[model samples]
Target: MLSIRNLHASVDDTEILKGLSLEVGDGEVHAIMGVNGSGKSTLGHVLAGRPGYTETEGSVQMDGQDLLALEPEIRSREGLFLAFQYPVEVPGVTNLEFLKAAVEARANHRGEEPPNASEFLKQARALCDAVNLDQAFLRRGVNEGFSGGEKKRNELMQMMLLQPKVAILDETDSGLDIDALQVVADGVNGLRAPDRSFVVITHYQRLLNFIEPDYVHVLVGGRIVRSGDKSLALELEEKGYRWLEDEVA
Candidate 1:
Protein backbone atom coordinates (compact mmCIF):
# COMPACT_ATOMS: atom_id res chain seq x y z
CA MET A 1 0.00 0.00 0.00
CA LEU A 2 3.02 2.25 0.35
CA SER A 3 5.71 2.78 -2.33
CA ILE A 4 8.94 4.77 -2.10
CA ARG A 5 11.24 5.12 -5.09
CA ASN A 6 14.75 6.54 -5.02
CA LEU A 7 13.99 8.94 -2.14
CA HIS A 8 16.80 11.39 -1.40
CA ALA A 9 16.48 13.80 1.52
CA SER A 10 18.82 16.07 3.40
CA VAL A 11 18.91 17.82 6.76
CA ASP A 12 21.02 20.91 7.51
CA ASP A 13 22.59 20.70 4.03
CA THR A 14 23.82 17.17 4.67
CA GLU A 15 22.20 14.46 2.56
CA ILE A 16 20.94 11.53 4.63
CA LEU A 17 18.68 9.52 2.40
CA LYS A 18 20.41 8.85 -0.88
CA GLY A 19 18.48 6.78 -3.38
CA LEU A 20 16.50 5.03 -0.67
CA SER A 21 13.60 2.90 -1.96
CA LEU A 22 11.19 0.59 -0.19
CA GLU A 23 7.78 -0.85 -0.92
CA VAL A 24 5.40 -2.15 1.75
CA GLY A 25 2.38 -4.13 0.61
CA ASP A 26 -0.92 -4.07 2.44
CA GLY A 27 -0.90 -6.17 5.63
CA GLU A 28 2.79 -6.88 5.32
CA VAL A 29 5.14 -5.80 8.07
CA HIS A 30 8.67 -4.87 7.00
CA ALA A 31 11.56 -4.47 9.42
CA ILE A 32 14.42 -2.08 8.63
CA MET A 33 17.70 -2.82 10.41
CA GLY A 34 20.86 -0.83 10.06
CA VAL A 35 23.74 0.56 12.05
CA ASN A 36 23.80 4.13 13.31
CA GLY A 37 23.70 6.80 10.55
CA SER A 38 22.18 4.46 7.97
CA GLY A 39 19.09 6.72 7.75
CA LYS A 40 16.49 4.45 9.28
CA SER A 41 14.90 7.35 11.17
CA THR A 42 15.34 9.71 8.23
CA LEU A 43 13.26 7.43 6.01
CA GLY A 44 10.48 7.59 8.59
CA HIS A 45 10.70 11.37 8.93
CA VAL A 46 10.75 11.86 5.14
CA LEU A 47 7.81 9.52 4.60
CA ALA A 48 5.81 11.28 7.32
CA GLY A 49 6.79 14.69 5.89
CA ARG A 50 8.44 16.14 8.93
CA PRO A 51 9.66 19.64 8.23
CA GLY A 52 13.36 20.23 7.32
CA TYR A 53 14.01 16.87 5.68
CA THR A 54 13.78 18.33 2.20
CA GLU A 55 13.19 15.74 -0.50
CA THR A 56 15.77 16.52 -3.12
CA GLU A 57 14.90 13.63 -5.45
CA GLY A 58 12.45 10.74 -6.03
CA SER A 59 8.92 10.17 -4.76
CA VAL A 60 6.87 8.53 -2.02
CA GLN A 61 3.29 7.50 -2.63
CA MET A 62 0.61 5.99 -0.46
CA ASP A 63 -1.76 3.92 -2.52
CA GLY A 64 -1.11 6.08 -5.64
CA GLN A 65 -1.42 9.44 -3.87
CA ASP A 66 1.63 11.73 -3.81
CA LEU A 67 2.59 11.34 -0.14
CA LEU A 68 5.43 13.84 0.01
CA ALA A 69 3.23 16.55 -1.48
CA LEU A 70 0.80 16.58 1.44
CA GLU A 71 1.23 18.36 4.76
CA PRO A 72 2.03 16.33 7.87
CA GLU A 73 -1.50 16.40 9.29
CA ILE A 74 -2.93 15.50 5.91
CA ARG A 75 -0.53 12.57 5.73
CA SER A 76 -1.77 11.30 9.09
CA ARG A 77 -5.36 11.84 7.96
CA GLU A 78 -4.59 9.92 4.81
CA GLY A 79 -3.80 6.78 6.83
CA LEU A 80 -0.05 7.20 7.33
CA PHE A 81 1.14 7.00 10.92
CA LEU A 82 4.64 7.44 12.35
CA ALA A 83 5.37 6.40 15.90
CA PHE A 84 8.20 8.71 16.83
CA GLN A 85 11.51 7.39 18.10
CA TYR A 86 11.39 9.93 20.90
CA PRO A 87 7.84 10.85 21.75
CA VAL A 88 7.75 14.44 22.92
CA GLU A 89 5.91 15.92 25.83
CA VAL A 90 2.91 18.21 25.53
CA PRO A 91 2.77 19.78 28.97
CA GLY A 92 -0.77 21.08 29.02
CA VAL A 93 -2.52 18.57 26.82
CA THR A 94 -3.81 15.50 28.54
CA ASN A 95 -3.34 12.23 26.72
CA LEU A 96 -7.07 11.74 26.26
CA GLU A 97 -7.52 15.23 24.89
CA PHE A 98 -4.63 14.77 22.45
CA LEU A 99 -5.91 11.45 21.18
CA LYS A 100 -9.46 12.77 20.88
CA ALA A 101 -8.29 15.67 18.77
CA ALA A 102 -6.29 13.33 16.55
CA VAL A 103 -9.27 10.99 16.18
CA GLU A 104 -11.62 13.83 15.36
CA ALA A 105 -9.19 15.31 12.87
CA ARG A 106 -8.86 12.02 11.01
CA ALA A 107 -12.63 11.51 11.07
CA ASN A 108 -13.28 14.99 9.72
CA HIS A 109 -10.71 14.50 7.00
CA ARG A 110 -12.37 11.22 5.99
CA GLY A 111 -15.79 12.88 6.12
CA GLU A 112 -16.92 10.61 8.92
CA GLU A 113 -18.68 11.71 12.04
CA PRO A 114 -16.64 11.94 15.22
CA PRO A 115 -17.37 9.38 17.90
CA ASN A 116 -19.65 10.53 20.59
CA ALA A 117 -18.19 10.94 24.09
CA SER A 118 -19.51 7.64 25.37
CA GLU A 119 -18.17 5.67 22.42
CA PHE A 120 -14.86 7.48 22.62
CA LEU A 121 -14.35 6.78 26.30
CA LYS A 122 -15.16 3.08 25.87
CA GLN A 123 -12.78 2.70 22.99
CA ALA A 124 -10.10 4.78 24.61
CA ARG A 125 -10.28 2.76 27.79
CA ALA A 126 -9.99 -0.46 25.84
CA LEU A 127 -6.91 0.93 24.08
CA CYS A 128 -5.39 1.80 27.42
CA ASP A 129 -5.90 -1.78 28.55
CA ALA A 130 -4.47 -3.09 25.32
CA VAL A 131 -1.24 -1.24 25.89
CA ASN A 132 -1.20 -2.17 29.59
CA LEU A 133 -1.42 1.47 30.52
CA ASP A 134 -3.36 2.53 33.55
CA GLN A 135 -6.56 4.53 33.14
CA ALA A 136 -4.80 7.29 35.10
CA PHE A 137 -2.53 7.89 32.14
CA LEU A 138 -5.51 9.10 30.16
CA ARG A 139 -5.69 12.02 32.58
CA ARG A 140 -1.99 12.85 32.71
CA GLY A 141 -0.20 15.30 30.46
CA VAL A 142 1.02 13.66 27.25
CA ASN A 143 4.42 12.12 27.97
CA GLU A 144 5.19 14.82 30.49
CA GLY A 145 6.14 12.60 33.40
CA PHE A 146 6.21 9.24 31.69
CA SER A 147 9.27 7.05 31.85
CA GLY A 148 10.92 5.85 28.67
CA GLY A 149 8.94 2.63 28.66
CA GLU A 150 5.75 4.52 29.41
CA LYS A 151 6.38 6.81 26.47
CA LYS A 152 6.83 3.81 24.19
CA ARG A 153 3.64 2.25 25.51
CA ASN A 154 1.81 5.51 24.94
CA GLU A 155 3.03 5.51 21.33
CA LEU A 156 1.61 2.02 20.92
CA MET A 157 -1.61 3.27 22.46
CA GLN A 158 -1.77 5.96 19.81
CA MET A 159 -1.07 3.43 17.05
CA MET A 160 -3.88 1.18 18.28
CA LEU A 161 -6.41 3.96 18.44
CA LEU A 162 -5.62 5.42 15.01
CA GLN A 163 -5.60 2.14 13.07
CA PRO A 164 -3.69 3.65 10.18
CA LYS A 165 -3.42 1.85 6.83
CA VAL A 166 0.36 2.10 6.92
CA ALA A 167 2.25 2.64 10.18
CA ILE A 168 5.93 3.54 10.46
CA LEU A 169 7.36 2.76 13.86
CA ASP A 170 10.74 4.43 14.40
CA GLU A 171 12.59 2.54 17.10
CA THR A 172 9.49 1.67 19.06
CA ASP A 173 11.51 -1.08 20.61
CA SER A 174 14.00 1.31 22.11
CA GLY A 175 13.88 1.70 25.91
CA LEU A 176 11.10 -0.85 26.24
CA ASP A 177 11.55 -3.56 28.82
CA ILE A 178 10.68 -7.14 27.97
CA ASP A 179 7.11 -6.79 29.26
CA ALA A 180 6.59 -3.41 27.71
CA LEU A 181 8.03 -4.69 24.45
CA GLN A 182 5.54 -7.54 24.37
CA VAL A 183 2.72 -5.18 25.18
CA VAL A 184 3.73 -2.97 22.28
CA ALA A 185 4.09 -5.99 20.04
CA ASP A 186 0.68 -7.30 21.06
CA GLY A 187 -0.90 -4.00 20.18
CA VAL A 188 0.69 -4.21 16.73
CA ASN A 189 -0.28 -7.85 16.23
CA GLY A 190 -3.87 -7.16 17.23
CA LEU A 191 -4.16 -4.47 14.58
CA ARG A 192 -2.87 -6.67 11.76
CA ALA A 193 -5.34 -6.89 8.89
CA PRO A 194 -5.41 -7.51 5.18
CA ASP A 195 -5.77 -3.81 4.47
CA ARG A 196 -3.12 -2.55 6.91
CA SER A 197 0.67 -2.46 6.52
CA PHE A 198 3.62 -1.62 8.77
CA VAL A 199 7.21 -0.41 8.49
CA VAL A 200 9.00 -1.35 11.69
CA ILE A 201 12.36 0.41 12.13
CA THR A 202 14.52 -1.11 14.82
CA HIS A 203 18.18 -1.74 15.61
CA TYR A 204 17.90 -5.22 17.10
CA GLN A 205 16.35 -8.50 16.03
CA ARG A 206 14.76 -8.98 19.45
CA LEU A 207 11.71 -7.11 18.23
CA LEU A 208 11.25 -9.55 15.39
CA ASN A 209 10.90 -12.32 17.92
CA PHE A 210 7.55 -10.89 18.97
CA ILE A 211 6.30 -9.19 15.81
CA GLU A 212 7.69 -11.22 12.94
CA PRO A 213 7.93 -9.08 9.83
CA ASP A 214 7.09 -10.38 6.36
CA TYR A 215 10.44 -9.06 5.18
CA VAL A 216 13.59 -7.77 6.82
CA HIS A 217 15.58 -5.10 5.00
CA VAL A 218 19.13 -4.01 5.72
CA LEU A 219 19.55 -0.29 5.18
CA VAL A 220 23.05 1.08 4.63
CA GLY A 221 24.55 4.36 3.43
CA GLY A 222 21.08 5.92 3.26
CA ARG A 223 19.59 3.12 1.10
CA ILE A 224 18.30 -0.39 1.40
CA VAL A 225 21.03 -2.91 0.62
CA ARG A 226 19.38 -6.28 1.12
CA SER A 227 15.88 -7.65 1.61
CA GLY A 228 15.31 -11.00 3.23
CA ASP A 229 12.90 -12.98 5.31
CA LYS A 230 12.77 -13.36 9.13
CA SER A 231 15.83 -15.56 9.05
CA LEU A 232 17.86 -12.56 7.99
CA ALA A 233 17.24 -10.91 11.36
CA LEU A 234 18.66 -13.92 13.12
CA GLU A 235 21.66 -13.87 10.82
CA LEU A 236 22.23 -10.18 11.45
CA GLU A 237 22.02 -10.77 15.17
CA GLU A 238 24.72 -13.38 14.81
CA LYS A 239 26.92 -11.77 12.16
CA GLY A 240 26.32 -8.00 12.34
CA TYR A 241 26.19 -5.32 9.60
CA ARG A 242 29.86 -5.81 8.64
CA TRP A 243 28.92 -9.08 6.94
CA LEU A 244 26.39 -7.28 4.74
CA GLU A 245 28.80 -4.42 4.06
CA ASP A 246 31.42 -6.91 2.87
CA GLU A 247 28.89 -8.60 0.60
CA VAL A 248 27.85 -5.25 -0.87
CA ALA A 249 31.45 -4.16 -1.33
Candidate 2:
Protein backbone atom coordinates (compact mmCIF):
# COMPACT_ATOMS: atom_id res chain seq x y z
CA MET A 1 0.00 0.00 0.00
CA LEU A 2 2.99 2.25 0.60
CA SER A 3 6.47 2.31 -0.95
CA ILE A 4 9.40 4.53 0.05
CA ARG A 5 12.50 4.53 -2.11
CA ASN A 6 15.90 5.85 -1.11
CA LEU A 7 14.32 8.25 1.38
CA HIS A 8 16.92 10.80 2.40
CA ALA A 9 15.63 13.32 4.95
CA SER A 10 17.34 16.11 6.90
CA VAL A 11 16.59 18.71 9.53
CA ASP A 12 18.54 21.93 10.10
CA ASP A 13 20.94 20.82 7.32
CA THR A 14 21.85 17.59 9.16
CA GLU A 15 20.79 14.31 7.62
CA ILE A 16 18.78 11.80 9.69
CA LEU A 17 17.33 9.30 7.22
CA LYS A 18 20.00 8.23 4.76
CA GLY A 19 18.73 6.34 1.73
CA LEU A 20 16.15 4.30 3.63
CA SER A 21 13.87 2.14 1.49
CA LEU A 22 10.94 -0.12 2.39
CA GLU A 23 7.58 -1.30 1.12
CA VAL A 24 4.36 -2.21 2.92
CA GLY A 25 1.62 -4.05 1.12
CA ASP A 26 -2.07 -3.92 1.85
CA GLY A 27 -3.17 -5.98 4.88
CA GLU A 28 0.46 -6.19 6.02
CA VAL A 29 1.76 -4.97 9.37
CA HIS A 30 5.42 -3.93 9.55
CA ALA A 31 7.39 -3.16 12.68
CA ILE A 32 10.32 -0.73 12.60
CA MET A 33 12.62 -1.33 15.58
CA GLY A 34 15.43 1.04 16.41
CA VAL A 35 17.19 2.68 19.30
CA ASN A 36 17.06 6.39 20.06
CA GLY A 37 18.49 8.69 17.34
CA SER A 38 17.96 5.96 14.77
CA GLY A 39 15.45 8.02 12.71
CA LYS A 40 12.34 5.86 13.24
CA SER A 41 10.14 8.77 14.29
CA THR A 42 11.70 10.98 11.62
CA LEU A 43 10.56 8.47 9.00
CA GLY A 44 7.01 8.64 10.34
CA HIS A 45 6.94 12.45 10.46
CA VAL A 46 8.44 12.77 6.99
CA LEU A 47 5.89 10.32 5.61
CA ALA A 48 3.06 12.35 7.15
CA GLY A 49 4.44 15.61 5.66
CA ARG A 50 5.00 17.27 9.02
CA PRO A 51 6.52 20.73 8.75
CA GLY A 52 10.25 21.58 9.20
CA TYR A 53 11.58 18.17 8.13
CA THR A 54 12.91 18.41 4.58
CA GLU A 55 13.12 15.47 2.24
CA THR A 56 16.49 15.98 0.59
CA GLU A 57 15.79 13.15 -1.84
CA GLY A 58 13.39 10.24 -2.16
CA SER A 59 9.92 9.30 -3.27
CA VAL A 60 6.95 8.20 -1.15
CA GLN A 61 4.06 6.68 -3.03
CA MET A 62 0.78 5.24 -1.83
CA ASP A 63 -0.96 2.79 -4.11
CA GLY A 64 1.03 4.25 -7.05
CA GLN A 65 0.22 7.92 -6.43
CA ASP A 66 2.89 10.50 -5.62
CA LEU A 67 2.52 10.84 -1.82
CA LEU A 68 5.30 13.37 -1.22
CA ALA A 69 3.83 15.69 -3.85
CA LEU A 70 0.67 16.30 -1.79
CA GLU A 71 0.15 18.61 1.17
CA PRO A 72 -0.40 17.31 4.72
CA GLU A 73 -4.20 17.69 4.54
CA ILE A 74 -4.15 16.07 1.13
CA ARG A 75 -2.29 13.14 2.64
CA SER A 76 -4.97 12.77 5.32
CA ARG A 77 -7.78 13.07 2.78
CA GLU A 78 -6.14 10.32 0.78
CA GLY A 79 -6.41 7.83 3.68
CA LEU A 80 -3.09 8.31 5.51
CA PHE A 81 -3.08 8.73 9.27
CA LEU A 82 -0.20 9.40 11.69
CA ALA A 83 -0.62 8.69 15.38
CA PHE A 84 1.82 11.04 17.04
CA GLN A 85 4.21 9.84 19.74
CA TYR A 86 3.18 12.86 21.75
CA PRO A 87 -0.36 13.99 20.91
CA VAL A 88 -0.71 17.76 21.04
CA GLU A 89 -3.06 19.50 23.43
CA VAL A 90 -5.58 21.96 22.08
CA PRO A 91 -7.09 23.47 25.19
CA GLY A 92 -10.08 25.21 23.63
CA VAL A 93 -11.30 22.48 21.27
CA THR A 94 -13.38 19.72 22.78
CA ASN A 95 -12.47 16.22 21.65
CA LEU A 96 -15.84 15.70 20.00
CA GLU A 97 -15.59 19.00 18.17
CA PHE A 98 -12.09 18.24 16.95
CA LEU A 99 -13.04 14.79 15.67
CA LYS A 100 -16.15 16.06 13.93
CA ALA A 101 -14.16 18.76 12.18
CA ALA A 102 -11.57 16.23 11.05
CA VAL A 103 -14.14 13.72 9.86
CA GLU A 104 -16.01 16.44 7.98
CA ALA A 105 -12.81 17.77 6.43
CA ARG A 106 -12.00 14.32 5.09
CA ALA A 107 -15.52 13.83 3.81
CA ASN A 108 -15.44 17.20 2.11
CA HIS A 109 -12.25 16.18 0.34
CA ARG A 110 -14.15 13.22 -1.09
CA GLY A 111 -17.02 15.46 -2.28
CA GLU A 112 -19.33 14.12 0.40
CA GLU A 113 -21.33 16.22 2.80
CA PRO A 114 -20.52 16.15 6.49
CA PRO A 115 -22.52 13.79 8.64
CA ASN A 116 -25.07 15.50 10.79
CA ALA A 117 -24.29 16.08 14.46
CA SER A 118 -26.51 13.29 15.71
CA GLU A 119 -25.09 10.77 13.29
CA PHE A 120 -21.56 11.92 13.98
CA LEU A 121 -22.07 11.51 17.71
CA LYS A 122 -23.44 8.03 17.23
CA GLN A 123 -20.45 7.01 15.16
CA ALA A 124 -18.03 8.69 17.55
CA ARG A 125 -19.60 6.90 20.53
CA ALA A 126 -19.23 3.55 18.83
CA LEU A 127 -15.55 4.25 18.14
CA CYS A 128 -14.98 5.36 21.73
CA ASP A 129 -16.52 2.14 23.00
CA ALA A 130 -14.33 0.12 20.68
CA VAL A 131 -11.23 1.83 22.07
CA ASN A 132 -12.48 1.57 25.68
CA LEU A 133 -12.50 5.35 25.96
CA ASP A 134 -14.90 6.90 28.44
CA GLN A 135 -17.82 8.92 27.14
CA ALA A 136 -16.67 11.80 29.35
CA PHE A 137 -13.51 12.06 27.28
CA LEU A 138 -15.54 13.28 24.30
CA ARG A 139 -16.67 16.32 26.22
CA ARG A 140 -13.23 17.26 27.50
CA GLY A 141 -10.73 19.52 25.76
CA VAL A 142 -8.30 17.74 23.47
CA ASN A 143 -5.35 16.29 25.46
CA GLU A 144 -5.62 19.02 28.05
CA GLY A 145 -4.90 17.58 31.51
CA PHE A 146 -5.04 14.05 30.13
CA SER A 147 -2.61 11.40 31.37
CA GLY A 148 -0.01 9.88 29.09
CA GLY A 149 -2.10 6.78 28.57
CA GLU A 150 -5.16 8.91 27.98
CA LYS A 151 -3.36 10.76 25.21
CA LYS A 152 -2.41 7.50 23.53
CA ARG A 153 -5.99 6.24 23.79
CA ASN A 154 -7.21 9.48 22.24
CA GLU A 155 -4.82 8.94 19.34
CA LEU A 156 -6.19 5.46 18.78
CA MET A 157 -9.69 6.83 18.95
CA GLN A 158 -8.87 9.23 16.16
CA MET A 159 -7.32 6.45 14.09
CA MET A 160 -10.40 4.33 14.54
CA LEU A 161 -12.68 7.16 13.46
CA LEU A 162 -10.51 8.25 10.54
CA GLN A 163 -10.38 4.70 9.14
CA PRO A 164 -7.28 5.39 7.07
CA LYS A 165 -6.03 2.91 4.50
CA VAL A 166 -2.48 3.10 5.87
CA ALA A 167 -1.87 4.03 9.52
CA ILE A 168 1.59 5.00 10.78
CA LEU A 169 1.74 4.70 14.55
CA ASP A 170 4.95 6.26 15.90
CA GLU A 171 5.80 5.03 19.40
CA THR A 172 2.19 4.49 20.47
CA ASP A 173 3.51 2.11 23.12
CA SER A 174 5.48 4.69 25.02
CA GLY A 175 4.26 5.57 28.54
CA LEU A 176 1.32 3.19 28.31
CA ASP A 177 0.82 0.74 31.16
CA ILE A 178 0.00 -2.91 30.49
CA ASP A 179 -3.78 -2.51 30.53
CA ALA A 180 -3.74 0.63 28.44
CA LEU A 181 -1.34 -0.95 25.99
CA GLN A 182 -3.62 -3.92 25.54
CA VAL A 183 -6.58 -1.63 24.89
CA VAL A 184 -4.63 0.30 22.28
CA ALA A 185 -3.43 -2.90 20.62
CA ASP A 186 -6.92 -4.32 20.52
CA GLY A 187 -8.17 -1.15 18.93
CA VAL A 188 -5.50 -1.32 16.24
CA ASN A 189 -6.11 -5.00 15.57
CA GLY A 190 -9.79 -4.36 15.25
CA LEU A 191 -9.11 -1.94 12.42
CA ARG A 192 -7.14 -4.49 10.41
CA ALA A 193 -8.74 -5.41 7.08
CA PRO A 194 -7.82 -6.86 3.72
CA ASP A 195 -7.25 -3.38 2.25
CA ARG A 196 -5.74 -1.65 5.28
CA SER A 197 -2.09 -1.56 6.40
CA PHE A 198 -0.03 -0.52 9.42
CA VAL A 199 3.51 0.66 10.07
CA VAL A 200 4.20 0.23 13.78
CA ILE A 201 7.31 2.10 14.94
CA THR A 202 8.43 1.05 18.37
CA HIS A 203 11.56 0.62 20.55
CA TYR A 204 10.72 -2.68 22.27
CA GLN A 205 9.09 -5.92 21.15
CA ARG A 206 6.46 -5.96 23.84
CA LEU A 207 4.01 -4.15 21.56
CA LEU A 208 4.77 -6.76 18.93
CA ASN A 209 3.48 -9.37 21.33
CA PHE A 210 0.02 -7.92 20.75
CA ILE A 211 0.06 -6.52 17.18
CA GLU A 212 2.15 -9.36 15.63
CA PRO A 213 3.58 -7.62 12.58
CA ASP A 214 4.16 -9.67 9.43
CA TYR A 215 7.67 -8.19 8.93
CA VAL A 216 10.22 -6.89 11.41
CA HIS A 217 12.90 -4.38 10.34
CA VAL A 218 15.93 -3.12 12.24
CA LEU A 219 16.66 0.54 11.53
CA VAL A 220 20.11 1.79 12.43
CA GLY A 221 22.20 4.88 11.61
CA GLY A 222 19.20 6.40 9.77
CA ARG A 223 18.68 3.38 7.51
CA ILE A 224 17.14 -0.07 7.70
CA VAL A 225 19.98 -2.51 8.21
CA ARG A 226 18.01 -5.72 8.65
CA SER A 227 14.65 -7.22 7.72
CA GLY A 228 13.07 -10.50 8.88
CA ASP A 229 10.04 -12.09 10.44
CA LYS A 230 8.80 -11.97 14.06
CA SER A 231 11.61 -14.23 15.24
CA LEU A 232 14.04 -11.49 14.28
CA ALA A 233 12.51 -9.27 16.93
CA LEU A 234 13.11 -11.87 19.63
CA GLU A 235 16.69 -12.24 18.43
CA LEU A 236 17.20 -8.49 18.56
CA GLU A 237 15.83 -8.39 22.10
CA GLU A 238 18.29 -11.07 23.16
CA LYS A 239 21.41 -10.07 21.16
CA GLY A 240 20.74 -6.31 20.94
CA TYR A 241 21.76 -3.84 18.23
CA ARG A 242 25.44 -4.67 19.01
CA TRP A 243 25.11 -7.56 16.61
CA LEU A 244 23.94 -5.11 13.94
CA GLU A 245 27.03 -2.93 14.54
CA ASP A 246 29.30 -5.90 13.87
CA GLU A 247 27.28 -6.96 10.81
CA VAL A 248 27.39 -3.44 9.37
CA ALA A 249 31.12 -3.11 10.09
- How many clashes in each candidate? 1, 0
The true-versus-predicted C-alpha distance at residue 222 of model 2, in Å, is 1.0
Cα lDDT tens digits, model 1, 1-249, are 999999999999899998988889989999999998999999999888888989999999998999989999999999999999999999999999999999999999999999998899899999898788899999999999999999999998898889899999999999888998999998899899999999999999999999999999999989899999999999999999999988887
- lDDT, model 2, position 201: 99
RMSD of each: 0.8, 0.8
lDDT tens readout by residue for model 2, 76-123: 999999999999999989999999999999999999988999999999
- Highest lDDT among the candidates is held by which one? 2
The models' CA-based lDDT, in order, is 0.93, 0.94
Q: Considering only N, C-alpha and C atoms within 3 Å, which residue pairs clash in candidate 1? A: 27-196
